[model samples]
Target: MYLPSFTLDEKLAVITGATKGIGRAIGRAIALAFAVAGADVVLISRTESDLSKVKSEVESFGSKAYTICSDIKDYAYIINELDRLIGARPIHIWVNNAGINIRSEALNVTEAEWSEIIDVNMKCSFFLAQAAAKRMKESGTGKIINVSSVGGHVALRTGVVYAMTKSAIIQMTKNLALEWGKYGINVNAIGPWYFPTALTEELLKDDQYVQEILYRTSLKRIGKLEELAGTAVFLASDASNYITGQTLFVDGGMTIYGF
Candidate 1:
């Protein structure tokens, strides 16, 4: 056949921060996409209620849905519980979509803020990926997707710590891809510019800020969740079987423009 298949049939996937903002959007989109492709999902979030809501939505697609209500920052607890929770099911895909950002000037950042952001964004991501890789190694095949940000590539006024972690993630993707390629694993990252999420809803309300953002973006519009989800699906499917160690920016041309 000339065309490659994007089907995720008979596979199982896991998504962290499966309940809010970008995480929720990507998680749900992936779950729905996987369902349509004939795969099941494991949704991870801090709130049981939110997990249940997404679980119901995923089940509507006629695929199995498992919910894990726990903090992603608690990587040890999560790594330990995953085996029990998943039982004999092998994870075919894992999305590190849980992230937090505190917008602040470099001069105003505090140690507590730095530590919290690092713990959640960087530390947990590494350990969790390590855990997921271990399970994926058994099957000798899997996809690991990291949710990075454009700030990781270009400097932004958002927060220095956040950028540092994202940059680390991009590098981490490359290193992991190199180390795991021999075992048939792929590691990649997605860097988004602006998407309408609870975190950015208020920020977008500022007309001047929106215009400033639009000025830098070639598309001159914020991204849709499905657009980002579509990218995730590509990376997760057989379409991306040969791709790894790359950060696909869903930034609407923001990275290429000059201020």
Candidate 2:
């Protein structure tokens, strides 16, 4: 009930890559948190079916929900639709959590694989941050939270390219925050260690990988989706009013541990 002053109440938030995994969990947290604080939500992803599911979940709390099934890689389409979506009101919050990671060793990585990871993770992150900042500047207030990973801050056990892309996200979060902070937009990122979602279900179940993730983790375990969701909400809300240009690691001390 403290949202207008201490929370994100009455804010309209848009979340990308909300169909599954980290993105999906972040979207759910954003929607439910905002609903509890009194706000509306709009969910976006590539699948209409998944968007429908999110909408249903958001509506469960009696909050207004909107959905758009579009690919973030198609920036033009996103721009056009964003205009329609924010017709008369400014978008108060934007969470860019949509990304993909294709793992390969350095020598074996394909040209196409490199391009896809870079385009989706780096290119898309920059442009979307740019677009959202432009609109936020007009309103003179907004927040943009990027869902990064421990991969960005550390080398991944399986994918170097994915790690590189995430590293770029950390810098992107910093640089964008530098440029947009004066415009009244707070730019920040969440770097998670090991969290189970649709993306990591198979890998998380593997004994070898599970042991590896746990061994390096100070908590001696992988993270729960709900655990990271709180950090997302804090970044999106007024509680973090003075925080910006930083990556909050929800990594269970994984980042601090010496390999």
Candidate 3:
């Protein structure tokens, strides 16, 4: 029996915001995927306690694991800490999933709220991608998978700032792919919609929220965290070596539907 070669064997992966939500789910799933394919993983987040628990999960998959605690919003911190970790070890895959969303309308948005949203989702993402691309370029190859949102490709009831940030991600992804494709670094994004996770856990349970989401989602249902794992594994592995500068929407076909 021949197994699919879609594994990330002998590779090293660095996952950001790995303590909770889509980040946590991705961390656990990617660790298992990489281990099954034979690779080691490094988990990053702000809490050592949370990191410990997550590390245990990854280790339970029978693969090696490392932990890093860094506030993604800290530019110097992100660069210094990540640089140290990747020292000597070649980074084969990078998942830029650390992010936050503010619920203020464009009119009510304060300077702080806007900065916080942009700092993590846009700024941190860009710099981390730059760092990873450097290491990848040295080897002439790597994968940068950014976790965007359905809000990114389409303006939802979310807010103007978030929508703007996400759309920026799609464009950033394309731009990175265009510039780095010749260098062998594939830049891509995954836009998730209505997933039941930490970030959306509160929002999903709201009756009004669910109604609005389902109305536009066409499928009339929210997404599951597990459902998104497969797509992440694909984009992070050799299976997607040829795919780049595109975003795969894991929405219930929401981006295409309109009232």
Candidate 4:
């Protein structure tokens, strides 16, 4: 009775971008983790084949996983489909993990690139959170986890637009948590530095870039997928019940470096 329970038993979770990179890792990890913890998961992604793969993995863990193959940018349809799929089940966890990056220099950033990143990263995330919040309010308890980045905290040379959206998410997480705390909704974010995901696969291949990354990271190594996923699980579980409106940086000390 003295120990706090971190079990997600009987809870339901929805994870966007559940097919690749950080999203896939987090989604699959969460799905499996949640399954072991006794929760059902809803995986949202754009590819049916990939969704099926993750679905199989989740089912292997003996938990039900429902897959939705749709672009998160089309959040309206996604939300509607979600309602139809779940049918009155209160969502206990919602992870906005779908995102894209155009990794261009500031001056070379095109309007199309800017719009695309903003739409998927910022716009889609907000509306989805809004729709999720409405449903969560009905149940009086829920957790909303936004997948932000270390780029949001410190300046990154990746691209201006991508950083802008991430920074905005951090702010959004705070404001939403403040507004929704009364309704028993906890809004939070996770910022990662470098992980071996498809998103960073190309960059990590560059020795110089890897060296630069290691120089900044106190841990001096790229993060493991499970490490990042563990952070998400903590935020989603009852362990973080009293925590909200904060971005947990899983950056291995990258944000703390200054010279």
Candidate 5:
């Protein structure tokens, strides 16, 4: 009998921003996928109730699920909580999916908004990855998947700070992979374009905004959350063991399309 290498059996995956939108979908999908493949999951979010709900959903997949309520911007709190929950448990995968953005032009972006966005999207992710990597280093193997955005690669008319932080994520992925490859830790990133997540809900409601997005996208439609989940699973599983230090863009060709 031959089994596929894609199975995550016996592995443990941790995902942040597990409450809503792309993060929620990725959390659920990864939990179920890993469960089906015989692995357990840990979900983290800002809301305990929502985390509990996702916990129930993941547990229904016949895999153990642990939930943590955390504000990603609070680095110390998150790291401490993670250490407490992960005590002596080998974490095979860590997904840094928590992020925030403010729709403001370059000149109009406030210091508070800029600070918040950077703290959540970049600073938190790096610190969290640092914490996870410490454990992974001990085990000599792990996967870290950062949820970046196509905005990181191209200039967007949206929030300039958001794009800046995302761009940093891409670089961070590369650097981490380069540094951690010796310890068998693979660091990578996923860049998604227009998706129907809560973050994009308001903009998607605008017909003109939607049309403008589709105009540059070869698929001419927004991405589905499951698609992003699939990519996350691939990165988390052994299927992508040979891959690292790369950003897989799930943008429906939007990044490559030229006006």
Candidate 6:
């Protein structure tokens, strides 16, 4: 029997928003996962202190860890910084996990709020992928994982713009896969449901919201952060070589089950 190769040995992965929440979880989990398989990682975030802490955690797994303290909002700066850190080395995986959401109703949303969400969640993600893809294209192989949300597929009460950005992300993944498949670049997305993180803390705290979420989900409970790690590892490794332009919804059947 031929078991699939899930090892990312000798690979280098770059994760944005690596300081906190899902990004932090993915950063640490993937770093350690890859390390256990013999890979190095580069953690990127706006906070130097947090980056250092994560770096220590990654290094604890006996893998080399590098940190980049910069704002993902600044497209040019991030691209330049990545180039500086990576030099001639090819990035085997790039996870675009940096995003923000404002919980305003559609009528209450402002121009500033709209732009900020678009800038950080959409614009920044695209440019970063472009930069990573350029390097990956040259190397003739790579993996790009975009962190989308269940809101992308089904509308949520969170905010209109946030849902819109995530929906765009799903489409973006497909488009990128179509364009870059020839270069051996696999572009895909992961849409998660209610997971306990800094971003969803307040929402998860509301009993009413929690009940609603559970009712819709087949698992009838929120997801654990660790539950997402395996999916990320699968996509980043050689096991998902034939999978591209796909959105793997890690939600607990929230997307498939309709009310």
Q: Is candidate 3 or candidate 5 better by TM-score?
A: 5
Model 2 vs truth, CA RMSD: 2.2
Cα lDDT tens digits for candidate 4, 132-211: 89989999999999999999999986678999999999999999999999999999999988887778888889999999
Tens digit per residue, CA lDDT, model 6, 1-259? 8878998888999988887755666556656666676678888888889989888877887888888888888768877776787789999999998888898999999999999999988999999999989999999999999999998999887589999999999999999999999999999999998787778788788999899889999999888877777788899999999999999999999999964
Report the C-alpha lDDT of model 1 over 134-247, residue by residue, as the tens digit.
Answer: 989999999999999998999997699999999999999999999999989999999999888767889999999999999999998999888888888889999999999999
lDDT of 5 at 236: 90
Q: List the candidates' TM-scores in order.
A: 0.96, 0.93, 0.92, 0.97, 0.94, 0.96
Cα lDDT of model 5 by residue, 144-245, tens digit: 999999999999986899999999999999999999999999999999998777788788899998999999999999998778778888899888999999
**Winner by lDDT between candidate 5 and candidate 2:** 5
A best-first ranking of the candidates according to their TM-score comes to 4, 1, 6, 5, 2, 3
Q: Which stretches of candidate 2 lie over 4 Å from their true place?
A: 1-6
lDDT of the candidates, in the order given: 0.88, 0.82, 0.82, 0.89, 0.86, 0.87
C-alpha displacement of 8 in model 6, angstroms?
0.9
Residue pairs with backbone atoms closer than 3 Å in model 3 (clashes): none
Model 2 lDDT per residue over 48-125, tens place = 887888788777877788877788899778877877876867888888888887768888899999999889888988
- Evaluate model 6: give its lDDT: 0.87
Instruction: Give, for candidate 1, the lowest lDDT window spanning 10 residues.
Output: 21-30
Model 6 lowest lDDT segment of ten? 21-30
Backbone clash pairs in model 4 (N, Cα, C under 3 Å; residues 3+ apart or in different chains), count: 0
Q: What is the C-alpha RMSD of each candidate to the true structure, in Å?
A: 1.3, 2.2, 2.3, 1.2, 1.9, 1.4
At residue 36, what lDDT does model 6 achieve? 70
Candidate 2 minimal-lDDT segment of 10 residues: 1-10
Instruction: Evaluate model 4: give its TM-score.
Output: 0.97
Candidate 3 or 2, higher TM-score: 2
